[model samples]
Target: MKVRDSFSLNPVGNTSKYTDFINYIDTSSVNAGLLSEVSFLEDEFPSRAQRLVRPGDILYSSVRPNLRHYYLYNDSYEHAVASTGFVLLRNNSSYNTRFAFYYLSTNEVVKYLSNIAELSQSTFPSFSSKDIGKIDLPDIDRKAQDQIVSILSAYDNLIEVNNKRIKVLEQMAENLYKEWFVRFRFPGHEKADFENGIPKGWAYRRADEVIDFNPTLKTGNQTEFTIIPMEALSTNSMVLDSGCFVRQDSISGRRSQNGDTLLAKITPCLENGKTGFVMGMPENEVLGGSTEFVVMRSKALTPHYVYCIARSYYFRQTAILSMNGADGRQRVDEDKLKSTKILQPEKTVLDHFETIVTPIFDGVYQMVQENKNLIQQRDLLLPRLMSGKLEV
Candidate 1:
C-alpha cells in the first residue's frame, strides 16, 4: 500500500507555531525514565519548531536510521517532547498501533529508508520525513497485523526477561562478595575460632604489602595516540559490543596489554565498576587509555581476587577517594594506586581461595558466555521476526 494513502506521514514539527521548539530528550532524561528507554533521544531544542510526541506516536530516527532506534509510545510515556526530524505517522482508524510498530521495524522499510537517503556525504545515511511519506508499505489485513505483532512481542518479552535476569545474577554475585569479603562475615561468625575475630588466622594487611605497584609502562614511546575505545570497554559484562581497532599509531603515554586489568580510570565508569581482564589485544605494544582507568596488577595476587575486589563498593570508594585532580575526570594517580592499602589474605589462604574462586569465576564466565549467545540469537531473530518473514 502507498504510505500516503492509508496512514499519512507527518513531520513531527509544525511551521505555523512561530515559537514551537524541538523537544529532544537528552541521555540524562532517558535515564530518568521520562521517555521510552528504547527511544533515541537528542537534546531538547527550545524553539517553536518542536513537536510534543503524544501517546501512540511512533518516533523514527531521521539520521542513522539503520541503528533501528525508534519507539511506539504508550500512555505512560506520553507528553514528552521530541525533535522535528522524527517521522510521525497518523495511522488510519483501521490500523493497530503495535502492528504498525512491527511493520515499520522491518528491514524492507529500513532498506527503503536507506536507499532514498542522501548518502553522498553524511553519517549513516537516512531519509527525511518526506521520503518516508512517499514510500510504499505492504498492506495486510489489520487482524493479521495484530496476530503478527503478538507473536513478535512474545519474543521481545522473553529477551527482556533474560536480560533482566542476567542483571540480577550479577547483582547477586556482587552482594555475596560484599557480605563475605567486604563486611567480613561468614557462616561461622559467632562460635568460630578467631584471630582478633578476623576469622581464624585470617589477617588484615595493607594493599601495599600484597601489591606494591604494577610494572611501569612506557606509554610514551608511541608516535600517535592509540587506545581501546570505550565501545570496546564492556561494563558489568564480559563481552564488549564495540570493536578493538585503533585509529592512531602512536601515543604520548603507555597503555595496557594482554592479561592487564583494563580498568576504566575515569569518572562514572570508575564509579560504575567498569573493568575487564585484557585477554586479546591487537598488538603487544600499543599505548592508550580514556584517562579514566588505573590498570592494577597483582604479581602474587590472584587476578580473580583482584577483579572481584575491584568491583566491590569498598574498592570503588577507596579508588575514587584516592583519586587526584579537581577536574570532573579525576584519576587515581600512579603513586596512590600503588600505595593504597588493601586487606591482604595469606598465600596459604589465597591458595585455598584460588580453588574456590576459580570455580565461581568459571560459573560466572559460563553465564557471561551464555548471555552473549542469547543476545546473538535475539539480535539475529529481531529483524526476521519484525519483518514477518520468519513469522514469529
Candidate 2:
C-alpha cells in the first residue's frame, strides 16, 4: 500500500473545533522527534499555520527533508496547528501509525526525498505531499509492525527519560543562578553590605568587560579540527550535538575551545535559543563552527557564570533587540551585544557558583553523550527492520 491510501494528508477544516488560542509548531522548531513549544492566539496565528494536527498524526517538513524536521503529534494541546511547511499525515488504514512514522523517518527515505527536492526547480530544496504519498509501504502484519515499534520505542523512551533528567539539571543550575544573582540572596545575604542596591563588591558592567564575545583564537599549524554546524546546537538544550572533524584548510568559520559558549546570532535561531555550552572536546583541541556563532569566553568571570548568563532571558532578549539586517537574515550586532550591561558578582561568589554548578553541567553532558549512543543504536536497527533485512 502507498502512504496516500494509508493516511489522510493535511486533514483540516473543522471550524467547529477551533478555539480562542492554539499551540503552533513551525518546521524550524522541530528536529528529529523533539519539538519546541510555541503558542499564539487564534487571530494572531502566522500565515503558514494552516494544518490542524490530530493526536496520532505525523508532521513532516516538506522543505529540507534531510534535516529530518519531523514530529509525532501527541501533544495534549486541544487546538494545535502546524505550519504548512509540514506534510501532515493522519493514519486511516490498518497499518500501525507509529510503525509508519519510524518508516518514513528512516535515513533512506529522507535521502531519497532529499534527492528529489534537490533536483526540483525550487530555489530551496522542497517537495510536495504528493511525493510522500506515492512511496510504497511494506505489506507487513499488524503484529510485525507492533513488534518493530516496541523495539524502537524502547530506545526512544530511554532517550526521552535522559532528556528529562538533563532538563531538570539545567533548571537546577539556572534557578541557583537566579537565587544568588537576580534575587540578591546569596550566601550571607543577611549580613551582606549593599551598594547601589547591589551586594557589596558586585557591580554592573558592559558584557564585553566581563565576557569576551567572539574572542580571538590562534589556530596556526593545526591540520584538522572538529566542526560544529548550526544545526548541531539545540534550541532547547545547552549541550551541543557531536560534530565531525574536518580539515582546517577547507571550511572557514569561528574558532572555539572547551568552556566557550556558542550562541547563534541569526534571526530565528537566536530567537529560538540555539545556544551551546562547549564541552567534552579533546584537551588543547580547538574547534571550528558556523560564522553565525558568537563565541563567548569569560574575561572577568567563570565559564559557568558566562554560560548561565547567556542562557538567561535578559541576555537573550537584549541580543534579540540588537539584531540588524534584512527581515529573514537579521543578526545580532556584536557591538550592541557587547555593550549590554551585566552584573559582576564578587570573585569569591563567582568561584563558589562555578564549583556548585560544574558537576551539574557535567551530569548533563554525560546524559547527552548517552543519548547520542542510544540514537546511533536505534538508527542502526531502523533501516534493517524497515527493509525486512532483520526480522522482528
Candidate 3:
C-alpha cells in the first residue's frame, strides 16, 4: 500500500487555545530521532514555526532527508509548533504508528526520497508530501506490525536508559567541581587559610596560564587520522563520537587527542553548549576535528578538571560574551577566551578532586561505548526485520 493510504500527511493539529508562549522545534533541532532543542519562546516566534505537532505525530524534515532529521513527537507540550520545513505524518490506519515510523526510517526508503529531493526544482534538496505519499509500504496486519515494533523498541529503550544514566553521571561530576572549586568547600575548608577572598595558596589566573588553548599537537607521519565534524559533538554531553578516518594528504582540521576538551567557538553552537571531552579513541590516536573547535589541553590542572570548567556555565558565558562577527556567524575570539580569569585551586585539592571524579568520567565513557554497540546491532537488524527476511 502507499503511505497516503495509511497516514494523514501534514494534518492540521488543534491549536485552538491562546497562550503567551510556545515550544518551538526547528528542523535543525532534531537529528536521527534525537530531539535536541525545544525553544520556549515568549516573544515573536519564527515565521516558519507554523506546523502544530500533536503527541504520536512523526516530524520528518523535508530538506536533506538523508541526514535523518526526524523525530517521533511524544512530549506533553500543550502548545508546541514545528517549523514548516517538516512533513508531519499522523497515522490514521489500523497499523501501529511506531511500526510506520520504523518503516519510514529505514535506510532504503530514506535514500529513495533523498534521490527525488535531489532531482527536484527547489533551491535546495527537498521533497513534498506527495513524494512521501507515493512510496509503497507493506500492508502488514496490526499484530505483525506490533511484533516488529517490539523488537526495534527494545534497542531504543536501552539507549534511552543509558542516556539517562549518562546525564546523572555528568551532573555528579559537575556538582563536585562546583563544590570544590567554585564554592571553595573542598576538604578541610575550615582549616584552610583565606586571604583577599581566596584561600592562601589559591589565586585567580588567566585561563591560558592553566590550560593550553588550541595547543599544537604532532601527528607523526600517519597516513590517515579520525575526523570528527562539528555535528558529532553533543551540546549537552561530554562524550564524543569515534569519528571516521580520512587520508592525511586530503584534508585536516584542528588536531586533538583523547584527553582534550573541544569547545565550539561558533555562535548558536557555543551558546547551545557544544563542548565535548574527547574519549573512547584508540590509544594515542591523533584526532582531527572541525576548525571551529578550540582544542583545550590541560597544562597545570587535571584533564577532568579542565573539562568540567569548559562545561561550566560561567566559562561558557564568558566565551559567549567574547564572540564577534555577524549574528549567525559569530565566534569566540581565541585571545579573549585565553585571557578570561579562572580560579586556580591548590595542587592538593586539584589532585583530590581528580581522584574522586575519574571513575565518574570513566563510567560515562563506558556507557557511551555501550550505546554505540546497541545502535550498530539495531541498524543491522532494521533492514532484515522491515523486509520480513528475519521473522519476528
Candidate 4:
C-alpha cells in the first residue's frame, strides 16, 4: 500500500502565532532515525516555520533524500515547528506509528526515496510531499508490527545507554586534562618550582615544532585504505565514524594514521568541535579523510597529549579566530594553526600525564567500537524483520 493510505503528511499547520520562543528542528539536527540536536527560533523566519509536530509524528527530510535525515517526534518535542524541508508523517488509525518509522528507515525505502529525488531534475534534488505519500509500505498485522518495533527498539535503547556512558567517560577525561594541564595542578605540583608563569622545565612551543600538520603518506593504487568523510566525524565525539574502503588512487584528502588527531577547519564544523582521534585502524594502516581536516600528529609529545591539546577550549578559540573566507565557506588559516603556541611540560611529567589518561581514552575507544558493532547488528536485523523474512 502507498504510505499516504496509511499516514497523513504534515497534517498540523500553525493555528496560532508563537509569541514566545519556539523549539525549531532543522535538517542538520536530524540524522538517520535519530534527533541529535534542535535550534531555537526567536522572532525570525516565522513563515518558514509552520509545521506543528506532536508526539508520534515522523519528520522526514524531503531535500537531499540520500541523507535519510529523519526523526520520530515524542512528547518532549510537543508543539515544535519543523522546517518545510521535512514531510511529517502522522500515523492513521489503520497503522502503527512505530512500525511505520522502522519501515520508512529501512535501506530499501531510503534508496527508493533517493531515486525519486534524482528523477526530479532540480539542482538540489528533492521529493515533494505528494511524492513521499506515493512511496510504498507493507500492511502488516498490528500485533506483529508492535513485536517488530519492540525488537528494533531494544537495540536502540541499548545504543542510547552506551552513548550516555560514552559522554560521561569523555567528560571525565576532559576534566582531568584541564585539572592537570590547564590548571597546573598535576600530582606533586607543590614540589615543582614555578618561574616566569611556567614550571621550571616546561616551555611554550609553536604547534608545528611539536606536531606534524597534514603530513603526506605513500600508498599505491592497489593499496586499500579507509576513507573518512567529514560527515563520518561526529561533532559531539572524538572517535571517527566507521569509515568506507577505497583504493589509494581514489583517496584525496588529509592522510592520517592511528593515533593522529583530526580537526575540521571549516566554519560551522570547526565551531561545532568536529575533532576526532584516529583510532581502530590496523597498525601502520594509513587512512585518508576530508581535506578540511588539519591532521595533527605528535613529534615531541604523546599522541594523547596532542589530542587533548587539539580538543582544548583554548585551541578551538584560537582556531576560530584564525578562520578567514566568505561567510559559510570560511576556513582556518593553516599557517596560524602551525604557529599557535602550545605548552609543553617536562618529559617525565608528560609521561605521567599520558599514564593517567591513556586507560580512560582506551575505555572510550572500546565503547565507540562496541557502539559501531551494535549499530551494524541493528541495521542487519531491521530489513529482515521488516520484510517478515524472520518472524518477530
Reference-based TM-score of each model:
0.59, 0.93, 0.93, 0.89
lDDT of each: 0.58, 0.87, 0.86, 0.83
Please list the residue runs of candidate 3 whose C-alpha ends up more than 4 Å from where it truly belongs after superposition.
13-19, 241-251
- Candidate 1 local lDDT, 1-392, one digit each (tens): 66656565663444333333333442212210113222323443345225566667776766656545566655443335655556666666676767766666666777777666656265647677777667655566777677766765665566456556655655665666566666666454456575764667666556656642444776545566556655355556543333343667665333666545666667656665567655434565655655455565666577666766777666667777877777876777556655655666556656665666555555545554565565466546656755557762
Residue-wise C-alpha lDDT for candidate 4, range 1-392, written one tens digit per residue: 88898888879686366766788887766777766566665666546577787888899998887777888887475358888789988888668888888888888888888888888987788988898788777878889988898988898888778778888888888888898889899888999999888889999999999998998887644367678878766666776656333445456788899899989999888887788888877888778888887899999999999988988999999999999999999999999999999999999989998888888888888887887788889999999998789986
- Candidate 4: list runs displaced more than 4 Å: 12-24, 39-53, 75-81, 92-94, 220-222, 243-249
Provide backbone clash counts, one per model.
23, 0, 0, 0
The residue-by-residue lDDT of candidate 3 on 139-214, one tens digit each, is 7778888998899999989988998999999999999999888888899998999999999999889999999987
Model 2 lDDT per residue over 193-276, tens place: 998899988999999999988777877667777888888887777877663234455436888889999999998898888998
Q: Pick the candidate with the highest lDDT.
A: 2
TM-score of 4: 0.89
Per-residue lDDT of 295 in model 4: 94
lDDT of 2: 0.87
